[model samples]
Target: MASQIQYADVEVGTELPAASFPVTRATLVQYAGASGDFNPIHWNEKFAKGVGLPDVIAHGMFTMAEAIRVVTDWVGDPGAVVEYGVRFTRPVVVPNDDRGGLIEVTAKVAAKLDDNRVRVDLTAMSAGQKVLGMSRAVVELA
Candidate 1:
C-alpha cells in the first residue's frame, strides 16, 4: 500500500493522478438502497420529469463520494482527508432511463497548509458536463 503522502514536502500546482468512475443505473439504485434516500426523483422518471428534471438523477452525495475517492486513492488513505467540500455548480441530470457514465476526477494542489496538510482542488465531469464535486480536499499526510 502507498504510505500517506507527507504533507510538508508538497508544492503548489502539484497534480495528482486522475481517476474516472462510471455511474450507471444499477449503481444509482444500489446507492439509493444503501443510503435509504429512495426519493422518486432519483429513480422514478415520471416523478423527476414532473419536477422538471430531464430524468432520474444520481444523488449529489454519491458523486461527491466518488470524487473524494480520487484524493483518497492518491493519498493512500481516505482517513487522511481532514476537510472537504464542494459547490454543486451543475446538476447531474441523470436520465430516468440511464444516467450518463464516466465521471472523471482530475485534481491539483491548489494550496498548502501548515502541519502536514495540503489543499486539493478538483474538477469532475460526466456526460460532457462539469459536475463540480470533489472541489477541494485538505489532507493530513504522514
Candidate 2:
C-alpha cells in the first residue's frame, strides 16, 4: 500500500504526531504468549528484581513495535515502511498497577531519499527514560 503522505509534501524536520501506549501486566502476558517470549523478566516482578531490574518489564520487541506506530500512523500504511531499526537502550518497566507504564513516541522526518522515500527518526521514552536509541524507519511515500 502506498503512503497517504506525499514525499514531495514532506520536509526534513517535519514532526509527526506523537503517540503514547500503555503497557500493563496483562499487556506483557499477552505479548509474551503471542511472541513466545515467556521470559520471567516480562511477567514476574520478583524474577525481574532478582535479575537486577526494578520490576516487571515489557518485551523489547513490543516496545519497539509500539514506538513505530507514530511513523506508520503518519504515513497511513504499515507496508509503506521499507526499513526500520532500533537499539534497545533501556527496558520499559511495567508496574503491576492500574496506571501501568506509558510508552511515549515522537517522530520526525530526518532525511529525504530518492525514490519517494524519507527517513523518519523516532524517540521512545518510558518512565522518563529513553528506551529505544537510534530508532529510525525508511518509508515509501506517495
| TM-score quality measure for candidate 1 | 0.89
User: lDDT values of the candidates?
Assistant: 0.81, 0.93
Question: TM-scores of all models?
Answer: 0.89, 0.98
Residue-level lDDT of model 2, residues 36-72, one tens digit each, is 9999999999999999999999999999989988988
lDDT of 2 at 81: 94
Clashes of each: 1, 0
lDDT of 2 at 138: 94
Best by TM-score: 2
Model 1, span 26-79: residue lDDT tens: 788899999988888877888888999877777888889889888988888778
- Clash list (residue pairs), candidate 1: 56-96
Which candidate has the highest lDDT of all?
2
